[model samples]
Target: MTKEANAAYDSSWTFIFAWLLLGISLLISGVRDLYDPAASAWTTWLGFISSAVFLLMAVNGMRLRRRRRESAEPAGAAS
Candidate 1:
């Protein structure tokens, strides 16, 4: 990989991991809220929805990384 592409790939991984982390935390919060006496139903729903969105973002990032890697490869390298 070129220097710039390598840098971008590394940064993309960083973002992907960040998204995954956020998703996990939010999912845990949502589940916890479900069992907490004082937690509002709306708060729980919001946490779950937000977690789904973040997890989707992480999945998209992974797809983008695959595309980037494929494009970076030489034309004849695939077969």
Candidate 2:
């Protein structure tokens, strides 16, 4: 592949993999949380934090993919 295309290809996969791994981590954390005897408030707070973390990663991955796609497009192409 051309260098530009290859760069975008690599970038998209990298972000995707990162986000996916983050998701898996959260899943694992959720399971652990289930077994923990922490106070309800603490568990709720932890869950909120995990959701926020996932949201951040997911947003970043989507943005990276969008940016790479835009960059890959030809300048004069039709909308």
Candidate 3:
């Protein structure tokens, strides 16, 4: 791949990684808050849901990107 294409690929993965990290952090925080007596029930559930959304986004992004790359590859070379 050309340098530009390689860079873009790396950047896309980086973005996905960032989202994954964000989701993990949110999930951890939500779990932690779940055990805290002072934590609000609504906010904890919100954080949990938000984390699920971010994680889903990251996974979907990775799947879509991989599909695109595979489709762009030559049929024989795809092996």
Candidate 3 versus the native: TM-score? 0.54
- Report how far off residue 23 is in candidate 3 (Å): 7.9
Best by TM-score: 3
Tens digit per residue, CA lDDT, model 2, 1-79: 9755665566566556656655665666667667774534454565556656655665676677678778878989737
Q: Which numbered prediction scores highest in lDDT against the true structure?
A: 1
Model 3 clash tally, residue pairs: 0
Screening candidate 2 with a backbone cut-off below 3 angstroms (N, C-alpha, C), the clashing residue pairs are none
Between prediction 1 and prediction 2, the one with superior TM-score is 1
List, residue by residue over 30-59, the lDDT tens digit for candidate 1.
676678836655555665666566556656
| Winner by TM-score between candidate 3 and candidate 2 | 3
**lDDT (Cα atoms) of all candidates against the true structure:** 0.66, 0.63, 0.65
CA lDDT, candidate 2, residue 14: 58
| TM-scores for candidates 1 onward, in order | 0.53, 0.51, 0.54
Candidate 2 wrongly placed segments (more than 4 Å)? 1-38
Clashes of each: 0, 0, 0
**Model 3: residue 24 alpha-carbon error in angstroms:** 9.7
